[model samples]
Structure formats: structure tokens, C-alpha cells
Target: MKFSITTLSALLLVSAASVAQADSYADAIKSWCGGLAVTAPKTSTVVVAGAKTKITVTRKADERTKTITGLDLYSVSKDGKAKYVQNVWKGNYALKSSATISDAVPKNVPAGLYYYRVWVTNLIGKQHGPDCLETSRTFKVTTGSHTNAAGDLEYTESLHDNSIYNPEHEVGCFGLSVDYPKAGDTFKLNQHIHIQANRDAASQTDALTKVELYKGDQLINTAWTGSESFQNSFSLKDHLVLDNADTTSDYHYKIHATSKKADKTCVFKSGDFKISN
Candidate 1:
């Protein structure tokens, strides 16, 4: 969905000078044509996949405004490039108006942070102002069901229930276990913590790249097979010990894993397990 420079220039009345003239591209577009203002989702909107997003846009095509013949919606890329994701609205003749664009986020869209912008196209089908309102013009996608091949993570204190700990009763590297940590499951400081990454039965070929424990954004510990991938299932049995000076706060530990079969490099996080002294 990458737009060509020529097409973009023609659509957005952006001159090479405007791009080079200002350090901030958005500011340059604003200077060029005052910019079309997007007035919905004042904050960073969370767009769950397969859901409808109601977007409201307004543009004034007067002497003070740039001629807006058409309106386009684009998702901004990591490299600060705009990729046309959807055409929210269009006009055969340029006029001043306001419209609400209801766009359905694709069910299979990748889970990550996304930013969208409205591009105003001129009478000749040339696009103008790449108006991305404000610095916080972004949205988020939580989980894509299609990419979530790994099952939910599990935890148990009983070795009998989790045969992976019992050498004689072990089934493969890890055994079939249940009694995963519930929403209110909490662990004591310095207690034996056992969590298992339930490999998707359908994704037996996918390699378990790594398993990590995190407290908020800080990494607590990690376990990964050296150069090889864990064949099917993996288990992490470690003592839950908070830093000596961090006794006052009850922190929640998060488990994340990377799967080769899912082709996802970004770690997929599971539910949080509370920890306390």
C-alpha cells in the first residue's frame, strides 16, 4: 500500500521545498494548506481487530484552505512513510464538508501500534496535506487471532499434576498439565514458580524461540534453547525472588514467548501473575 512520490505529490499539494523547508513534515503540510483536521478519537484509540471504527473528519475548501477534491486514509509506517490502508471518503467535486467514515479493522490485522492520517486530494486527483493531527495520533491493535497459534500459558505447583517435573512420568519434554494460574493467582516471594508454555497442538512444527519473564517493561529473566529450538513444548521452573530493595511493591510478572511457526518475532505476552512478599 505504499504510495509513489509522484502520486502522493500530485494528490497532496506538497512541494519539494515544503518537505525540505521544514523539519517537521506535519508542520510543513500545515503551513502549506492549514491541514484537514481530524476530530475524533481524541486520545490513542484501541481498535480491536474485526471491529468497526467510527472516524470523523472535516475539511474546509475555502480561500484559506487547500482544494480538497478527495479524502484518503493511510496507516503510517515505522519509517515515517504513509501507506494507503483505506479510502475513507471521496468527492467528484471539491467542496467544504464534514463526514464520518466508518472503517472496519480487518480481523487478521497484525497486533501492534498503528497511526493513521487523512490525505486531502486536489481537483486533479493530486493529494495535498498529509494531515496527521497532533503528536499522539496513534491507535493500537491488541491480538490477531490468526497469528496467535500458541495456546495460553499455564502454571501449577503440583509436580504430579505437571508431569514435566517428574522424570519417570514425563511425556516428551513437557507433559499434559492443567490448572493454569487464574486471574487472581498470586505468588509469594522466593517461592518455586513453575510456568509452562502450552504449545499449540496444531503448531507442533513451530519452534519455541524463547521464554521471558518481565515485570512491567523491565526484563526479569529469560530462558532459550542455545541455537536449537524447543521441539514442541517448553517449561520454566524458577524461584520467584524480587530484588532485595523491591519488597514494598507487589509486582505482576508477565510471561512472553516467541514462536517460529507463527513467524512473529515480537513476543506474545500471556496473562499477568501477581507477586508479593
Candidate 2:
């Protein structure tokens, strides 16, 4: 899945006259502007079946104070089909709030290419404006679980259509990446394996709470932990020793991160490789 940030920004900048010309739910949401800005995911995301995925709606206000009154989610398929998923929230919610909201992808949603959009209604001094925003890129829902060489469950993300294993940049509020052990690189037993996690720079008011490393389902190490603010790019590193692994099996490293700004925890898995005896 991929998100086009430029396209979304262009949609938000549509003139009121153009917005008025359309009569769709999306157009209606785009028509009103009371100085409330909504930011969605900046990159493609992937979630497994039956797993809870978070969708965070970040709001910025202008001179007028705005209160979020309602929130809804819609799913869009590859064939341009749109369906209402559910009402995420209703009633008055505060602005500039760091509260994280989340919902699970319907267990029945088949494995395929799809994207979600969030519609928000806000009140600015009795005036109501409903604005719509979508995930910058499409996301994937996989029915199969990913496992490592040890046959343990592993964290995973959708690869680009071209099958390239690149780190997700700016998922919701912050970006995550693995710098070392480029996907599919093999190593020898007893060789010191160093893993690195990088968080891209962001302009949101949020903090990264944790960065952890995993080998299959086993917790290898906790790289960093704290309420670290996201202002600049930073990296965390950890060393691993595979003493009990067999050379015939495939292996991979998975990075997990938690951020208050995101509705769901960020996860990215490395490409499969092996340990040569």
C-alpha cells in the first residue's frame, strides 16, 4: 500500500466553490472550513486479520476554537467501492488532545488491498463543518500470520506492490525504519548481529514511548524506552547473538515501537535471511 501526501493536501485545498459544486458525502465534508485541520497516515499500513489497528485523527486549530462532535470511518476497495465501516466516535471531543482512538479491522474483511478514510464533524461557535481525510496510502489486511525461523509469530508490514522491503516512513505521526541487516542478508553463527531502528522527523505533538527488537515471537531486546518527543530524527541500536538457531531455517528481525500519537503501535519486519553454520 502507498499513500500520496501531495494528493491529499491538494484535496484539502479545494476551493469552497468547487466543494459546493459536488453533492457527495466526501464533497460535503470538504465544503466547510472553520480552521480545523485533520492529519491522517502519511504512509501505507498493514494489519493482520482479527488484529486491532488504530487510526489517529490529529487536529490543528486556527484562531477559532473547535470541538470535535463526531467521527466516522469508511473503507475503500481497489475497485473504487466504498462502504461505511462504523462510527468511531460521537459526541463532543476536545481539540489538540493526545488521546489515542483505535478500532479493529472487521474480521470478515478478506485479505486484499483497501484503504480507510476518516470523516470528522466539528463545532466552531455553533457552526458545524464535517471534513473528510483518508489514509495517504492504501493498507493491506493479511489472513496469514507471519512467523520467524523458530516458528514463532513475527511482526510484519505490507511490502510495496513491487515486493520491495522498505521501512514505513511517517506511518501516522512518526516514521519507523531498520537500518542494519538489510532484508535477506545472511549471517554466520556466533557473528555479532547489530540492529538499528530509526524514527523519522515529524511535526506533531507526540512522543515515542518504546522501541523493541524481536526474533520471531521471542523478545530479543528492548532498545529504548521513554517519553521521547518527536522533533528530530533519531536511531536506536541493539546487538543480538543467535546461539541456538539452526542454519537450515530462515530468520528475520522485527522492530516494534509505541507512540502516543498513533492509534496503534508501529511495527515493521525485516526480510527473511538465514544463519550459515
Tens digits of per-residue lDDT for model 1, 1-277: 1234554466346444643443364345456545356566433465666777765656655544333334444443332223455654555433366656566776765544343344454332354444223211345544432323476432222223322122211111211121244445677866656556554322212234555566667776663333323323444455554465244333333433333213334333545567766
Deviation from native of the Cα of residue 254 in model 2, angstroms: 43
Q: Tell me the lDDT of candidate 2.
A: 0.49
Clash tally for model 2: 4
**TM-score, structure 2 vs. true:** 0.40
CA deviation > 4 Å runs, candidate 1: 1-32, 64-97, 122-136, 144-277
**Model 2: how far is 182 from its true place, Å?**
49
Candidate with the greatest lDDT versus the true structure: 2
- Write down the lDDT of every candidate, Cα atoms only: 0.43, 0.49
* lDDT minimum window of 10 residues, candidate 1: 168-177
Residue pairs with clashing backbones, model 2: 2-137, 3-136, 3-137, 170-175
Candidate 2 structure quality by residue, lDDT tens digits, 112-137: 54444444445568666554333324
Best model per TM-score: 2
